[model samples]
Target: MGTIEYTGNHHAFRDKLRRYLDEAVAPHGEAWEQAGIVPLSAWKEMGEKGYLCTWVPQAYGGRGLDFLYSVIIMEEMAHIGESGFMVSLHSDVVVPYLFTYGSEEIRNQFLPGCVSGDIVAAVAMTEPDAGSDLASMVSTFREEEDCFVLEGSKTFISNGINCGVVIVAARDSLEEEPYNAISLFVVEAGTPGFEKGGKLQKMGLRSQDTAELFFNNCRIPKANLLGQRGSGFIMLMEKLQQERLVCAVSALAGAETLVEQTTKKARECIYGSGMPLIKAQEVRFALVEMTAHLKMARAFVNDLVNQHAAGANVVVETSMAKFLTTDFLNDFSRRSMDLLGEAALDDDDVFAKALRDGRVMPIFAGTNEIMKEIAARFMGL
Candidate 1:
């Protein structure tokens, strides 16, 4: 039995999107990984085919589809072993800010371009000194006569190089009420004084364009502020449920893919005298263990997604899921790589790439330590 009860249309959509990726996206994974970027053309093709921002309203040039479509697309992205596109990050992570909190003017200005793929978006939250802990952030945004001046820098931003617009969280005041002073602002790329640093080399997800973002006395209209003043932290807290859920789903998908490929290879690989790798008791045990573990993870993630889509508050649960799934995938990928022997270092080693990419799952969307703290606090233990 499967976790998600995908409808026929959902299956059809998945098949169509999978075909598109096979042709237009998957072929260039190695090249993009080497180049440290996925081109804008891939994003444009996604938008044109209705594979991007499926949850956005139709008025904003989207298909006005449900969240499941976005989920399908993300799972397929993992299946193809290409994380650079980051459609889920743009579709579910950043665009929701505009769709939910932006003023009519801001929405009308940005959401259309976002859906059309004319403008790629990113959210800048992590800084050189501060990550997971939002209150410690020192980036400041001061109100001037006609606009707000942003000053400080963000590090380790996904989609940093490719982003046309970024949602920047900055300290609204330097003194007094530091936590309450944080606010989010939409800073378009190339805004004077707002600069994207050179792409940062990462262990994996090389094509995802992670980099540093600098704001040197940048200025933008007050209208760019997302939601009310001093509400950025609250807004971020609300959206984290979805963000972490995305991490859990993608981690599970990646884990499943790696396990599937490794097992298939083991079944056919000959050691001596036509002895299959899978015929070894130890090898067979590992494969069965992975399958067993992932089955439970999938069921838990699927249930959480159902609750989340229904607007139920599952913050603690999703946090647990994020922590567990990420930890599991990291371990699973490492073990799978060792099991694959020297073949794991081949140029086309998908398992090796999965291991590298899985390393960041726990760190991003809040660390596993943070997730444990959140879940523990809720449990009153």
Candidate 2:
């Protein structure tokens, strides 16, 4: 795998974060999973420790750290098998929209809370009928003098229940072109007509709150419009490079964790002949294959991270990494489960959760099929 130079400060931050997760976050993973959501206290604690939104400017209460800090947080969270908290989505994916496109007034109002974890942020783009195809979204917003009134619903929204604020993409009611009609808006959680639906029961990531959001005449000041009117498509596209990169990082990390755990289990399990399972040629070869694939993925993702941090446009590369790494994660987890047989089915076994959760990786952050489509288009196919 390619090496990422870590300064003393970066190493120090990772060490501190690892200790904190071991103490505070790792212990509550199962409880959060049972409750179907992570507690607000956990989010607040991470924020107080400067583990949230490390990239926001110092003026916005963040440490003004670089993208690598965010990468560290994702890796550490994945290592501990904690997916529910979703710090990456808030810190790396959604909050960037607010920081980059929000007006100074808007930034002043929400960015500090985001950095402090007082405000959890979510981006609502997918509706019932629209997932990868943003242009087909049915949500609509109309200008009404001083306010924009939004009327529609969004489903499969991550952080839906916990979010204090959301960046919503809705179409202008009068615009005819789907591509040009959509605009982004910053809507606080308790807006009059905005309501968060109950958390949906899912096969995986049970602790992460996913729900439907309804906007029935939901009104926000015109000032809440993010960037140019009718520019939501462009804005969403612009930020996807980073979003896909984050997905790739998380997938690769999760794959590595799964392999490490499975290898340890293989070393401990005894065969019918009284030898360790790892002694079996097939098991050894499987472990070796998984490790080799992970090494290649780690190198690719790390290089993309370096390019992204350097301000290079790596949208196509990131999209490829997103699908490739996530596909590997799913395959690795499934193979681990098969190799472990009945032991992997235990209620407390981490492999079950890993397997289930890994299934969604290729589906979200734009499906693997969509990722290939994007890469193909960029490659002049």
Q: How big is the positional error of residue 117 in model 2, measured in Å on the Cα after superposition?
A: 0.9
The TM-score of predicted model 2 comes to 0.99
Q: Given candidate 1, what's the lDDT at residue 375?
A: 90
Q: lDDT tens digits, residues 1-381, model 2?
A: 267888999999999999999999999999999999998888888899999999999998889999899999999999999887799999999999999999999999999999998999999999999999998999999998889999999999999999999999999889999999999999998899999999999999989999999999898999999999999999999999999899999999999999999999998998789998889888889999999999988889999988999999988999999999999999999999889887789856899989877788998878999999999998999
Candidate 1 lDDT for residue 10: 93
Clashes of each: 0, 0
Best by TM-score: 2
lDDT of 1 by residue, 1-381 (tens): 236778999999999989989998999999999999999988887788888788888788788887888889889999998977799999999999998999999988998889888889999999999999999898998998999999999999999988999999998765568778989999998899999999999888888999999999899998999999889999999999999999999988889988999998888778766888888888889999999999998989999888888899999999999999999889998888778787677756787888888899999899999999999899998
Give, for candidate 2, the lowest lDDT window spanning 10 residues. 340-349
Model 1 TM-score relative to the real fold: 0.98
lDDT (C-alpha, whole model) for all candidates: 0.90, 0.93
| Model 1 C-alpha lDDT versus the unseen true structure | 0.90
lDDT of 1 at 304: 89
Quantify how close model 2 is to the true structure by its C-alpha RMSD in Å: 0.9
